[model samples]
Target: MDAYKKAGVDINAGYKLVDDIKNLSNNKDLGSFGGLFPLSLGAYKNPVLVSGTDGVGTKLLIAIKANLHKTIGIDLVAMCVNDVLAQGAKPLFFLDYLGVGHLDNEKAKDILAGVVEGVSQAQAKLVGGETAEMPDMYTHGHYDLAGFAVGIADQAKLLSKANPREGDVLLGLASNGLHSNGFSLVRDILFKQNTYSLNDRLAGCNRDLKDELLRPTKIYVKSVLPLVEQGTVASIAHITGGGLPENVTRILPDNLSAVFDYGSWQVPAIMKDLQKIGHLSFDDLLHTFNLGLGMVLAVHSGDADEVQSQLQAAGEIVSRVGRLTSGDKQVIIRKDQQ
Candidate 1:
């Protein structure tokens, strides 16, 4: 054993892990200095590259605490690919970075498998990734994951804040659960403050607490990409850390605001449980968590019905949650009159 191995950095094990990744992802060029992707501008007259990067957030803690590593990688890919999808791009390739205190080949393989699944779900290729073994940087049996996704879209057809206009209807896609946000608060409330265990089943929830917390984020690429291509979508918002109010406002023009008809869609029971346990206010819930809707779209009023129909046909649970109105660039959640 050399001095470097003695210091906890195993060069040979890293090389073996590279082979493991190549087998898991089937990317032969993964061990190279940089990942390679063959880009073909099939239908894009003027192709524009859209890129996004994100991490799984403190949600990793839940996975680690439960010793569940399979689905976290999906969250990693969803966090990035969904962002690019929000910009009306088709995800082309993905890359991941995993940092760990010690290299455990089995655990690493499980995590990479989820990444592979995520890429498959997004219809993107996993070109390459890096696994860093840093002693003392992270605790043993714990790792951090970050992912980068690159997508392509026609320069003229790219969705932006300017794309949304007044009278456009806002369509919200239902989220499965927490979908990888507000975990810092979730952890504080469920574990630090309350006595809930991952094994305990909360009211209205079908699965155990661990299953709810670790539910992988839903990838919107497959369902929303078709709408983007059809040009029915004016703008899309991938609700994440800032929840609906913060994320929806990002794609709203300065003179337009999003008026959401709250209670239009079913709020996942897990979210309600957390709110009650934490005594969270509506505003707090709005600012921190996704609150059920994962991705919201601003569609032209004329095409709202057709778009909703198409989303339903694609097996997406969507709601006519809001509309764009003449106001400052903000989100207004109001009770539904009808």
Candidate 2:
């Protein structure tokens, strides 16, 4: 027999994946090889293409530990889409890559279904993807997923860190608790505490720990794209592996830094539990976990309240977290002081 057959990777599963995704793969319209998007020049004076690619980090280990394979696909899509959105681009299409030790049809299907769900939520087309079953690696019952997303925006319409000025306000949209980042530290906490199962519910949290952990990364595309379309936001930051302090600064101009009043928003209960139980310090908690806020938008001070109102009406928990200041590169998190 073939090497794949000898190595436990079923060649039949590869055929089945393509066959099952025929409808999805055939939705291409423009010049993408595996996936396509129609060029609609209806709205742009001069359009520019923005693309981002990202993978769900070690968070896959948690999903594998909990035997929860489906929702991680959403994380894969969200990671890439959110990054592009930070550049004021609306996601038009998404593609994925799934790699594993061996092909498991049921698990692969579950993952793809979640990816489709994420694409639908982001209002983007699910184009195509690569699924590789590499035997003798990754150990059984484990896999990794990543995704790429492409978006279009007018060259002049795209946002830049230059928009952030001395008086711009920082508005934070609450996260759904540790969404697809900081899992390495989280796993460390669990291992250090000797807790093997993620399903064990925390002391005061409303949901099982595994359920909370598996909560799909939020797709802020639809919610924030309208604001970008209206030309209201100055800059946007997607909080990923690095917590607020680091991620927020990436989108700030060289002359501006963020001065965050960390007490402005309430920290979610799960983070509180992690801090108290795991004996994590304030610095670690702020630098490692989302602490409830996911995405932050920098806008003119005059528009801050209005933008917050609009985002709130759209069902996003918007908070006035801080302000842009004239300084060198650094993010300052402090309480109001005398």
Candidate 3:
């Protein structure tokens, strides 16, 4: 074996992962210096390319602790693709980066499987990815995941905050669970302070904590893209690391802020459990986590009901959670004064 192989960097094994990815993604031509995607797939006179990148965050620690590696890639893909989707882009291709101390075959396969599945779900191509086995860089049997996604949208169709009016309604799409954020706090509360194991089933949760924690981030591309294409959406926000306040403010006009009714939607049980355990205030929860809303849209008031019904028919659990108002604060909380 070579010196690098002796240091746990296996060229052959990594190539094996490449082969698996090729077969899994059906992209035989993927090992170039840069990935190539044709711009002629459809017709758009003034095309604007959009791209985004993100990682799975500390949620990977929970997955690794639980020995549940398959679904983390889904979270990786969701974190990346959904961001690009927020700007009314149709994601075209995806790539992933996996850094590990040692490459275990079954574990690598499981991770790649989730990536392939996520790409299929987003209707995008898995154009390329990398799996690096660094001996001392990461702890033994531990790895981290990051992903990149590129999308395309027309100039006129690009959604922005400037277009949202004062009367626009904020429609919130429900999150599956904790979609890969606030995990450092989650781990601190659950493991460090509360002494709860990943195997420990909470009082209200049907499954164990690990299952709830490892629940994959929902990809909103398929759900929100149609609404974007219809020209009904003024702005879209993907609820990620910064939660509602920060993420929603990204797409809010200076003259218009969003007013949310906490009572208009139900916070997920897992989140409530986290709040009670950590003694985290409601403001803390809103800024730190999704609080059950994954993707929110600012749309015309007249089209709110139709958008909700159509999104429901398209298999999305959506709620009319808020509205745009004249304010300097980007997001104002009514706190059950609905």
Candidate 4:
């Protein structure tokens, strides 16, 4: 009713937008009736379907505030796709769910554009999605996004934490910026320092703070997938909501631990700002944010150099951040010597 719009949900617009993408989402792998994958499975002795679902968290607030909605859809897709890839799966298809308090056609279109863009980048299909217009649930012009990604990998090829051993190298892939995690703390620091305006230009980055903040989470699907073919990759950790310490530890086997020499790589300027302003301790920063490294690759010690060279040649910012050590499952962060 009219009151629904007044309350912030525009149900009619939501219906039309969903109809708009239906034609564009025709995937041969996806069935007319159900989620589909009807291909010859002659290659794998055993094929395992891997799936992951994720949403861009409160970081959507930053995008919404900056009026930059396109890339967050990229973040949504990347978040889900990248996670499945961590398990050594090849992303085959993706589906999204959008919930908006009120619907605006232009805004919905922009968001879908991003999803399409991300799917294209990841070489995955946008099979289908859901858009909900729930008036009372969100404020006007505010919406949230979540995505589901399905990938496939041979059961024997799946990266397992069962054998992450001591002396293995931790190769880190660089992040563009914050990459969809640690925004809450970052926002707090910026606001407390009175630096929340997206329009304001950052001093050294030569871009608006909003531009830097809302940068989409990097999709590691392209860069790391090839390595899976080599069978040298032991495990991977997609550093997300719980920063390096927690995330890296997640994929590490019980007999293994990470010994990070924090000085090994340069922390990006944006994170440096937070560290300086918040006076947050080392552990807090490492456990709460990616800092600079976005994805960590746990590779066999013999394959470390080759992997690093391959990644760098691919124009990826890769570094040997640390090594696995013989210890209880723990993340050891060593301070840079001043």
Q: How many residue pairs clash in each candidate?
A: 0, 0, 0, 0
The lDDT of each candidate is: 0.92, 0.84, 0.88, 0.83
Q: Tens digit of lDDT per residue, candidate 2, span 1-338?
A: 48859768787778777676654434533223556567898998889889999988988888887887888888888888988899998889898888988888878888887888788888998777888888777795888888999999998889986677898899999998889888887787776666646768887678888898888889898889999998899999999876988898798888988988878987888788878877998888988888888899998988888888999888999888889889886888885631
Whole-structure CA lDDT of model 1? 0.92
Which is superior by lDDT, 2 or 3?
Answer: 3
> lDDT by residue for model 1 over 48-88, one digit each (tens)?
99999999999999998898999999999999999999999
RMSD of each: 1.2, 2.4, 1.2, 2.6
Model 3 ranges off by over 4 Å: none
Q: Which has the greatest lDDT?
A: 1
lDDT of 4 by residue, 14-50 (tens): 6677666664454543324455555557877898989
Per-residue lDDT tens digits for candidate 3, residues 221-322, read: 887888888887888999998899999999987888899988788788888888999999988888889989999988899989988988999899988898
Error of 2 at 160 (Å): 0.7
TM-score of candidate 3 to 2 decimals: 0.97
Ten contiguous residues minimizing lDDT sum, candidate 2: 23-32
Better of 3 and 4 by lDDT: 3
Against the true structure, candidate 2 reaches a TM-score of 0.93
User: Using TM-score as the measure, what is the rank order of every candidate, best first?
Assistant: 1, 3, 2, 4
Cα misplacement distance, residue 59 of candidate 1 (Å):
0.5
